[model samples]
Target: MKSSILTRPFYYLWTTQTTANAADVLYIMALTVLVLNRTDSLVSAALMPLMRSGAQMLSGLIAPLLMNRFKLPALLLLSQTGQCILFLCLALYLQLNDNNSSLVLVFTLVFIMSFLDGWTVPARNALVPRLVAHEQGLLKANGLISVSDQVVQFAGWGLSGLIVAFLGPGHTLLLTVILYGLAAVFTLGVKEPPDVESVRRHTAEDNSAAPSSKWHTLTEGWKMIWQMSRLRLLTFMDIIDMLGGSVWVGAFTLAFVQVALGKGEEWWGFINGAYFAGTVGGGLLVLTLARAIGNRYLAAMLIGMAGYGILTALYAINTRPIIALILVLLMGPFAELSIVNRRTLIQRSVAKETLPKVLSAQASLLNLVFCISLLVMASLAEWFGIVNLYLLAAGLTLLALGVGLIGRRTFHNAADPGAGD
Candidate 1:
């Protein structure tokens, strides 16, 4: 028989994530349109993502406390259920108020819903190793998840416009509520292994022997990252890569298309579409090569980072629109290789009980870094020009590659699951 990881429970998890992700895209699109219509301000529309990110960052910071109290599946269920209920309220409010809906109340609901949703990723990741019977299963599992996410991203944006166009923002939000409800239902099927639960229980007991303060619970993940050598290096490289990666955000990418490629919004759509296509392809590639990559996770990550950096540099200088599209499409697989392997490494680098807290900390740091990068890169683009801005991003990626190179031995040792621990 095949492993349980490939069975019903994992499928439930996958379906829950897929539906929830779809709901996320739909709600964001609907909200942005609603805000734009109501406030007639681009700045107000933009504030949606900013507010979501801020709330999620705050959520990640405090997630450890909840992780300690609830099991991973339970935490996931809570998040999905909470989002569903909040979205229902939002939908009802929109329906009742019609033209007079308050943006303040809308944004407040968005923030709280986002805060509840923040636990999903960390909890899901921590559950993966528990769900899998073999260590190598992680590569295939992560690849599967990545592929689904990329597919959702590729199709979601395109479809959401039509959805909102037909149903209007209010009705579209009602659709989103349905998706969230489906996700919560599927989340109920995810179950942890008995052995894993026992280990977590023992770990909790050990920790409870000491009087754990709130401050310590909050900082536990941060402290783990600081103390673990491999984790520290991986996180540093992740920070640099994230800083560099911010160039691909919608506004910056649009700016690049206009300034460097001399193209318009149509090309912007093509570019985004191509990048997601590439990521889907990359995810498939990782799935095909899961066994081989699992044996040399560190090497694959380094190569991926290096290739992405090189492609980014070439992309920055090229003036041809066709070539720019190709470069970004090619950048996808390399980006996925690095991202999936690094995530797998992080999962394997710590004990089962500690993984959620560590991941929460890392997620918090990356979210904070990404927000800052957006601002810093926007300023650099303003000061140095669009072409030079991408070049700077490429330089940051190479710097990340350098960090990985410096810690090669440590990463090599960590290639085996649980080796670093």
Candidate 2:
């Protein structure tokens, strides 16, 4: 079973990707703490996420062009190596500078690194089918990827504060530099498929039409997603869900820890870790039932969405810290079930050649929504209070569930035709 899904090259690619992701979480968490400590201004600390999101928005828009032109392996190499260099520079800046003037440089590096990340997500997803080599294998591979990513996230976020406290910000930055450098090294071993040009040239006689104009080619991804009813609906669901999903972000959680829980800052870390730990459990459940999930994915996703809304609502009303933690922990499995199913559907539904573009468009669209949602939600939280904000989030999730029901047939059609119900 393992041999069917975990080929050698895929193993290397998975390892490289997971390591990069862990380092990303660790770096961002470290940077937030560092900035808050250095400036002692919440506004200054907030700018980092804003900068990263802005960079991601641009990156998502442009990544399709790069993916179409360059080989995936080359893009992966460049992104990893670029981040490694940026971290090294940030580490050096921290070591050398003694004033707030260096904050600009730190933000600049973060923006650039995040921009590089936008390209990496779509490319990685597009490349997965190639590495795994079969339709059945894709499900298992995605399950593994989901579980492993949650594990990495849990470890990275859980340990980051401790590591930072022990090593200090500069040393923490240096450690990330090392992690990203190692990620680059492993990425080098990924076996990229033949370039698109080579394949086209080999079949030139059979497909001799001139290529489409650059504008058409570049916009094709968006067009495909828009034209496909299922994809369009799924994309819409994602954007809507994120409106509520924004609350799970650290910014709001930090506020919740302070205002709602009446706990110290460290509870922020605990809540975040608990959420990821629950996702890990949910992913494991999905992995074990991957085949069954493939059959009823649409129902599973809708149920998951509904559960998230209900659970988040429950969490918001609870005054007890332990009870709140339990509610957040319960929230994770539902979110994971929906997310994993959604990703698998995309991979299965889209054509391989256009998958990168579709995925990139989706990422760009989602990131844009996230940036706006974070701002809007944060404002609403301030106006209405966190509990009311969560209730609003629950309302949005229920709305998404309604949309999911209306669009159920789209995903129902997506189930494996070969498999018996």
Best by TM-score: 1
Error of 2 at 380 (Å): 0.7
Q: What is the TM-score (0 to 1) of candidate 1?
A: 0.95
Would you estimate the TM-scores of all the predictions?
Answer: 0.95, 0.91
- Please report, in order, the local distance difference test score of every candidate based on alpha carbons: 0.87, 0.80
Q: For residues 66-133, what per-residue lDDT tens digits would candidate 2 score against the true structure?
A: 77666777889999999999899888888888454377778888989999887888888888877876
User: Which lDDT tens digits does candidate 1 get at residues 283-355?
Assistant: 9999999977655778888888899889999999999999989998999999899899888888888888788
Task: Give model 1's clash tally.
Answer: 0
